[model samples]
Target: MQQDERQRKMKIMEVRMREIELSLSNVKLLLREKVAQLKEQLHKNGKADVLIGNLYDENDVLLEVLEKTKQRHIILEKKNFLLEEKISSLNKIMCDLTPPPSLPYHY
Candidate 1:
């Protein structure tokens, strides 16, 4: 009778071991899926970081070009003002040099 009881206990222990192993396998599968998802997210974030950096660099370049354009515009305005002043002076000189028309004096 004792031998039969021992055999029965052994069978119960084997069944419990199989259940534990199946549970462990399920846990491992879930962990693998979670890890894969995390890796994909990291990859996407890295790409976004690079794109944002490029855009920032482009913006900086555009700002520099705008500043240069503004400076050129200011310089051109100064030159235009000087040329206008010179033209006015030349016109006055031309008028002074020209003789007026001779007309008869009438009381």
Candidate 2:
């Protein structure tokens, strides 16, 4: 029973390893095909290839800037909330400190 169980586990592992290898081979083949296609396009449209590269770089830079802007916006929102709370507290204090006006003398 022990030997049989061990054999079964080994067989399962072997099958899993084969599946992983097949997947890796498929991925490599797809990468090769995509590279060939891109090379062919570059050869056919030289100016377009350069434009694509420039556009990709610009897109990367814009995405980075957008991320930074979003982070700054979050920080600013927090600061605004804190300032609003502080202003409200100060207003309450000022109201408490100020005295009401006395009535004028009667005729």
Candidate 3:
């Protein structure tokens, strides 16, 4: 009985392995088909091939520019905030230094 049970378990494992291998093969085939389709499309439109090839580089450059712009924006915002605070402080000092208006005496 124990031997029979072991054989049954072995068969189940074998079947599972085969299913996994078949799934993998199917995925590989689909990927190959997709690549072939893309190649065909590229062949039909030769100009698109260059664009597709350079797209990654172009995207990288654009991303770098965006990052630099963001950094500059942050710096400008901080400077603006500091300037506002300084202006507020100067206004307070001016108000403090001013003398009060004298009242007119009765004629």
Candidate 4:
């Protein structure tokens, strides 16, 4: 009877050990899946970071171009003003140099 009891206990212990091993395997699988998901998220975030950096660089370049264009516009305006002044002075000189018409001589 004691031998039978011992055998039964051994069988029960074996069954329990198998259940524990299955539980551990399931936990390991879940951990692996979670790690994969985290890695995917990290990769996507890295791409976004690079894209954001590129956009910032583009914005800085555009700002520099705009500043240069504004400077050129200002210089052109000053040149136009000087040219207009010169033209006005030339017109006055030309008017002063012209002679008036004279009356016809009497017989």
Writing each residue's lDDT as its tens digit, candidate 2 over 1-107 gives: 99999999999999999999999999999999999999998787998888999999999999999999999999999999999999999999999998877788899
How good is model 1 by TM-score? Answer: 0.61
Model 3 error, position 18 (Å): 45
Q: Lowest summed-lDDT stretch of 10 residues in model 1?
A: 98-107
Give the alpha carbon lDDT tens digit for every residue of 2-96 in model 1: 99999999999999999999999999999999999999999999999999999999999999999999999999999999999999999999999
Per-candidate total of colliding backbone pairs: 0, 0, 0, 0
Give one digit per residue, the lDDT tens place, for model 4 in 1-107: 99999999999999999999999999999999999999999999999999999999999999999999999999999999999999999989988887766778899
Off by over 4 Å in 2: 1-44
The local lDDT score (0 to 100) that residue 77 gets in candidate 3 is: 100
- Where does candidate 3 stray beyond 4 Å? 1-42, 45-47
TM-score of each: 0.61, 0.56, 0.53, 0.59
Better of 1 and 2 by TM-score: 1
Instruction: Name every residue pair that clashes in candidate 3.
Output: none
Judged by whole-model lDDT over C-alpha atoms, candidate 3 comes out at 0.95
Q: What lDDT score goes with residue 102 in model 3?
A: 77
